[model samples]
Target: MIKTNTKKICIVVSSLGVGGAERSSALLSEMLFDLDFDVHIVSVLDKIDYPYKGKLLNLGKLKAEDDSKMGRFKRLKIFKNYLKAHKFDYVIDNRTRIGLFKELIVSKWIYNAKNTIYCVRSYNTDMYIYPSKFFAKLLYGSAYKIVSVSKAIAEKLNNEFGFKNLEVIHNQVAIDAEELLVKKTIKDNYILFFGRLNDDIKNISLLLEAYSKSKLPHNSVKLKILGNGKDKMMLKQKSDTLGLSNHVEFLEFLVNPYPFVEAAFFTVLTSRFEGFPRALVESLSVGTPVISVDCKSGPNEIIVNEKNGLLVENHNIEALTNAMNRMLEDKNLYLQCKSNAQKSIEKFSKSTIGQQWKTILK
Candidate 1:
């Protein structure tokens, strides 16, 4: 009798950065490892921001310390050789495929289409890059499955690229009540907003504008913005100009931000779009209500208006301000929302999502 080898999986990502998509990939890798599968990760970049339970193959060292492009082709050959040696049963790719033509060529030439799973983790991804729509079919048509993190993203991809094998698998959020409810740095009653401080996509300007217009600033309730990004200085300048310098506090990115989320009266997100907003689900998991923009995707799926949290019109400053004021001042409503938060997000628990991936892989 011939013995079959234990299934080996490889998760390909840009990097294990602190972004939502990177964290989700790491979490999935962790889950696969816990299930007794041989798991490996291939990160294009060297940065490892999130924790993972896999053997890492960092390609960041391919370039010299000076970031020279001299060994680009040599690195590609090395990467292909590495994949050939491991012979992964399934390569679940989680990187953004927008403009990665060279990488796409590597994937196309080296990876078996029947054993690959391409993941699209952003809403309307084709719109992000100029030629993505035109190249979508060419890039992902060979993959066995194309997974999207939300129904919105899946539908968008299908409409734009006509991918017949597209699947929607929502990301999971796990919260240890004891860990999240533990002591936080700030002991004050405050509303929270945490993500990369990018104005164009995250539109934190909408958040700051809402906070400035809200009544909570006058009632001793503070607004805490967490996470650092390219627009930090610009956002800080805006806050100063809005006279919110005193009321709004910008906090640096914390690896563990759940404690802050748990301690907040409620968390807020004002993004233009999302594949799946992990922060909102995470906030709910930590027993904190959220107020978020009803963006292109994600939020509408998670937030049942007036149930677990409040959903405001996308980029509507007045509506967001009113929602924030309600979350702060409306004690009874706030309590009701808080009480309903955890239960509403049970579907997004790690075990439930892990089972989905297990089924698909099997």
Candidate 2:
């Protein structure tokens, strides 16, 4: 049974599907609900896949039904009405705020600034605060709080925008008890890279290059790249060109990728930048050590070099290749990392992060 509470909170998100930030929002809703707050979710998009605990206001469904300009106005009116009706104690805005005019209207006319919290979930600040830095400051200046998912993001915002109300909260992972208990059997020896297949940000090409150079291919270890994106075909072609057609395997995104992570030799990340890389943390939580390029704002915080996992310098193809080779050849080092993996990420557990949110909400 859910306990009742007077402090009502609403989470506004772009979608609750297929992305790290969206997953975090879904987890936040469940956390707030479990913390006895009357949690409500307002997903702007209609792609709800993750399990969440809250009353939903799916504006995307409404948009899908009526996509006309008039329909947009109607949705806006409905959104304003819903906020007015609920009188929520706090509204956490987790959507990308790139449209300056649209955000200005929403901030000035719709949302109550003093009770609203804005979240910045990417290293690319332009996605969350666009047009101009001065405008972003003016826009979010009076917000109850501006929460950055990593300390690097928070520091960047502070340095660039001089915003005083900033908080750093790392994304939490939902470690399943059943998953932990299940005995994972490795069917094949493959290194894994899961998440969006975007090349611009994820830098998957770098991963492919590093994998091709690594000694794992000679040892008959395959490279499994999972998830879908616009660059899927391109990445596949690159794999073929690298003569890795037989060695590299592409799998579609899975709702629960824990089994894949658990069964892998280890997971690898080669992103250029990240707000907080969930794949690395998720991999570690399942007792799988990871090899990641020490990208901006995330990997340094999560990985201890040669401890829980290997953290190579960003964009260094040779360094990553060497790390991968070491992980495969160094049995003692790999075992040590695997043993430390699950315990290293205990700070990112749901309950620990939930308590942090509870304090922020209060």
Clashing pairs in 2: none
lDDT of 2 by residue, 94-187 (tens): 9998688889888888899999999999898888876477898779988999999999999999888889999998999886677556565657
Model 2: runs farther than 4 Å from truth?
A: 179-186
Error of 2 at 141 (Å): 0.7
Model 1 scores a C-alpha lDDT of 0.83
- What lDDT would each prediction earn against the true structure? 0.83, 0.90
lDDT of 2: 0.90
Cα RMSD to the true fold for all candidates = 2.7, 1.5
lDDT of 1 by residue, 167-248 (tens): 8889988654565556756778899999888888899999889899989889988889999899999999999999998888
The clash count for each model shown is 0, 0
Clashes in model 1: which pairs? none
RMSD of 2: 1.5
